[model samples]
Target: DAGITQSPRHKVTETGTPVTLRCHQTENHRYMYWYRQDPGHGLRLIHYSYGVKDTDKGEVSDGYSVSRSKTEDFLLTLESATSSQTSVYFCAIADRGNQPQHFGDGTRLSIL
Candidate 1:
């Protein structure tokens, strides 16, 4: 039970709408990441932040964006979400670069 939480555990929306998922941590870890899990693709990184106001895009960041203004929170936004964006999103945090990451349960989102 490391300090991590994800909001909107379940959601369903239209294909052209916007969606925002949230990740909150209480451990004040310096590394936070957003990833999406698909059936056969495993986990693909969407974005990450190493510190406040310091963020970077990841492999599958085409339609996603993220922000880390405070040490405890990280937000992921899907601009004009599509059916292709329907998947399970997870939030993870690690204390150091090579340490094991702790993950939030997940956010299951679906776009019709």
Candidate 2:
């Protein structure tokens, strides 16, 4: 099945606003992740979910949060957006089947 899919492929917002990015999967893959990409810093994990109603904060999860319900949906939210948060965000998936993680196309967010 297709691993992860994202919505609103592009966005531009002013700082201090709110933004939610959705990640939808074709099947329940046991793991879903949100990451942000910048120039100097490579991909950074923002948050992730292991199962419905089960999630944990990642290394770079200060202003971000995530949730999952059922098997196929994971949501990432930026409660208060900031210019420093302007980045290309990606959603990825993995499972116990030993397959490497796969990612979505990504969302390009520009905070003004």
Candidate 3:
């Protein structure tokens, strides 16, 4: 298994409200990433971290932020929830950049 777990499997909120999703891994992988999956968009990267306190913006970074204060934890936050941002967010872990990644179930977010 991936040894990855995502919190709040499902969530619904009003537009403009802030939302945060958590991803925790027991594998202690060096790379942690956040991505959003939409109907036609597939998976779009939001952010990634290579090590503790080391992070980078991804393909769709606007209105979103991420933090990796520890190797086992990664947090993704939507500063202000919007309808366009409603989607299933997934977290992936990779031991190395070239290695295959493992993914968590996902967090389904809905904005009204």
TM-score leaderboard ranking: 3, 1, 2
lDDT of 3 at 37: 98
Best by lDDT: 3
Q: What is the lDDT of candidate 2?
A: 0.89
**lDDT score, candidate 3, position 111:** 97
List candidate 2 stretches off by more than 4 Å. Answer: 97-99
Candidate 3 — number of clashing residue pairs? 0
- lDDT scores for all predictions? 0.94, 0.89, 0.95
Native-referenced Cα lDDT, model 1: 0.94
Clashing pairs in 2: none
- Cα lDDT tens digits for candidate 1, 1-112: 9989999899999988889999999998999999999999999999999999999989999999999989999999988999999999999999986799999999999999
TM-score of decoy 2: 0.93
Residue-wise C-alpha lDDT for candidate 3, range 1-112, written one tens digit per residue: 9799999999999999999999999998999999999998999999999999999999999999999989999999998999999899999999997789899999999999
In model 3, which regions exceed 4 Å deviation? none
lDDT of 2 by residue, 1-112 (tens): 4657799899999999999999999866898889999999999988888778989998899999888977798999999999989999999998852577889999999999
